[model samples]
Target: MKKTKTRLAAIAAVALSAVLACGVLAGCASDKGEQKASEQPEQTAAASLEGKSLNIYCGAGMTKPFQEIADAFKAQTGCEMNITFANAAQIQTQINTTQEGDFFIAGSADELKPVSDYVATSTDLVKHIPVLVVPADNPKGIQTVSDLVKCDTLLLGDPESTPIGKIAVKAMTDAGVMEQVKQSGSITTSTTAPQIAEALAKGEGDAAIVWKENAGKDGLTILENSGMEGYVKTVPSAELTCAADADAVKAFSEFLQSETAKNIWTKFGYELV
Candidate 1:
């Protein structure tokens, strides 16, 4: 009887040891599984986008900032970006004709209207405010919107082909000064906001109405309280229907609103939406 009891006790001890070993092994495995799960998302994101490519239609005014954002995106995901920079209206026309872009980044939501059917998703990214820009030092003493009439030459974006141009007309009309502006000075129109800024830099006009961000360029100064506070436009980035890889497009669209992209935009003087 004593021998049998001793043998049973030994058997119980072995069984307990086996159970404890399994528990420890299971604990280790569980820890390893959790660690792997924690690491999976980032790895999966990079893997999914690696070697993918996207075609982007970006506004000409946003070129500098968007290029930086694109560089960051490519570095993170290993994706290639093929960007086409033009005025928002011109980009809209291109989208309608080609139907071959992955995304469209416009200066205003209005520019997206013509290509609405081709858009799968749209996200407002920044604010595009119109401001009166003049040569540094206020050479013409142009201090107000109404004062635009006193200028010898005025530069404006083409109302038919640029978002800034459309906003310029509407804002002035809302202020009841559009007719006066048109009648007083020789108005020169450009197809893009950058062109207007360039013209101003080259001393092509005494005053020019361009996007607020462009007013930061060298040799330009924004006129404070120029009465354009009410006419701000929202910049939008849209995913197009032509995106061959929806996953890749979605990833990039998300990146456009990421903190990194926001920093880039702000660095270029754009206001966050």
Candidate 2:
């Protein structure tokens, strides 16, 4: 009876070891299969692009719709999109200095001038107008473009590197208040419209000139006055002449001109151009 019991225990141990070995082998196979599956998208994307990738330098404000459009493009074509959003002027500067990038989306056509040599062509997509945004209480009594000269702390986009800033500077210059505002030591500068909006919301400045779409932020008020007229800036997407694959860039540009992309821009409150 003792010998019989010992033999039965030894057989049970062997059976358990075999089961554990099978489980380990199955797990290894499962992991390898998953890794291959995860690599499929990238493999497919590379094939779709014919091994070429697109690089985009986009304006900060256009990020929302551009992202939506990029995702749609990726899903349809399996091509990869590398997008970087920043001040449009800054983007142009980088593109010019590096002589790289496949496309440039500027806040305005004026911003694209710096990279004209690298841009084969471009299309105007939307319009964004400048507006004076103030705290809800209307502090400093700022009611018009003329009032900007009176604010103790007035914020605007960096005119040298921002499209809105250029427009704001031009408008203030036209109003003959640019010199006064600058001399008054009241002018503050930001890189983008969203930054200007944030400064207004934080009460960091008495007022800021920002895009109309950004005027609706809480704790801020859009000063509606005719003085803000003629400040319209248009958004344009340029196809770069330096692109490694012109066909791919052209296809993406065509997508931007589609009704689908137009709807995406409209959904973000941009006026279709």
Candidate 3:
């Protein structure tokens, strides 16, 4: 009878060990399930706007930085962006005619005036500064706004179509030399900043007033204190009334002011407001 009791005791011990082992395995499974559940919310949030798309009207000068921002936004939310780039006036006309864009990003706040009634909300993103750029080696010896009269050919943006053109006129006018600058040289009008930069790079013009960021192009030198101070324009991004997806537009609008977007703008030579 004692031998039989010893065997029974050994069996009972094995059974207890098996039960504890099973309990430990079950606890591990529970922990894993909780971890997976905790991660779901983040995944869901990242893909909340998946399969959605937005139409954006952007200024031509902002193409580089805004393109990178749009790519980053697409990666985070899996949404697609259709960007239309042109001079501010052209973009304003497109927005009014189409009546179908999610956001409007302009070189200046003034560009948004015609579309103000269509803008649901707006935010200032950066500074649009105009600077005088000349070809390398200062071929014309132009050193100041007053010296612009020396150039046989001077490129200026069209005040009716470009923010830089308006700012250039105002800067020269503010310094009391607009008429002389015009009379001393042939004032050639461009429709966009890149066009002015391109014209300068090819030696098509002696000097041009363009956005400060455009001065980064090759074969150009920005002249300091050429009388453009205090004529800075504010770059503004606005959500339009024609936004097809409000949530997606809101998400992108918020992203425009994020640190990531600011870094891109700075990388492209833009100054944050």
Candidate 4:
């Protein structure tokens, strides 16, 4: 009976040990399962954009602000950006031909009209104003569109390809001195407003009608703003139909409206729209 009781006690001990071991294993499994469940969504999100990149076709004038914005976006979202800068017309043409770009930023709304079919949505990002830019010392006494007639070399954007040039022509025409200015000043033209600004800074031309932001460069000063006709332009941004990742594209679009982007734009002499 002693042996029987001893054997019975041993059996009970074995049973209890087995039960404890099972419980411990189950507890460990439960903890591991909970950890995996929490990590799954994070892993999936990280995987989604692990190798993804976005393409943006932007206007040359917006390079400064957009580049800063792009850096901030990549740090926050872990997505990469490829940006192409050119005149609005050239970018629009590329959008039409390639059908591969993700976003388009035009210096003016008119630049978006021709490629309306490719643009899925648009928002006014900022206001652009065209101004007469001259060397730091207001040589030649240029103060208004009328005064452009006295410049030895007058630089402007290519009206056929750039918004600034088109607006410059209108302002000159409205000022009723388009013909006189052309005849008096040696007319020089560039493909983009920013280029014209550079030319004016280098003294390549005595005067250049460029965007107000461009005129903010160190060695340049605004002689006069081509009053409100061509000067009061809005910079518009659009998401094209060819966007591969709509969520990523939309996120960037929203970022453009964010306070961070607004600060950068303002720093670059752009007013939010």
Over 4 Å off in model 2, which ranges?
1-52
Provide the RMSD of all predictions against the true structure, rounded to 1 decimal.
Answer: 3.9, 11.3, 3.7, 7.3
* Candidate 2 displacement at residue 244 in angstroms: 1.6
lDDT of each residue in 211-248, candidate 3, tens digit only: 99888888899998777767888888898988999889
Q: What does candidate 3 score on TM? A: 0.86
For TM-score, the strongest prediction is 3
**lDDT winner among the candidates?**
3
Which pairs of residues clash in candidate 1, taking residues 3 or more apart in a chain or in different chains?
none
Question: Which residue pairs clash in candidate 2?
Answer: none
**Candidate 1: tens digits of C-alpha lDDT, residues 1-273:** 999999999999999999999999999999999999999998888867887899999988888889999999998898999999998777888889988999898888888889999998899999988898899977789887777777788899989988888988887787777898787757889988888999899888899989887777788888889887878888898889988888788788888878999999898888999
Q: What tens-digit string does per-residue lDDT give for candidate 4 at 1-273?
A: 999999999999999999999999999999999999999987676446545688998889789888998888776667898999999788888989988888888888999998999989989988988888788887787878878888889999999999988998998889898999777747889998878888888878778888888887788988644353445988888889999997788778877888888898899998788
- TM-score for each candidate, following the candidate numbering: 0.85, 0.78, 0.86, 0.80
Best-first order by TM-score:
3, 1, 4, 2
Give me the displacement of residue 103 in model 2, in angstroms.
Answer: 0.8
**Local distance difference test, each candidate:** 0.87, 0.84, 0.89, 0.84
Error of 4 at 263 (Å): 1.2
Total clashing pairs in model 1: 0
Error of 3 at 6 (Å): 22
Backbone clash tally for model 2? 0
State the local distance difference test value for candidate 1. Answer: 0.87
List where candidate 4 sits over 4 angstroms from the true fold. Answer: 1-48, 224-230
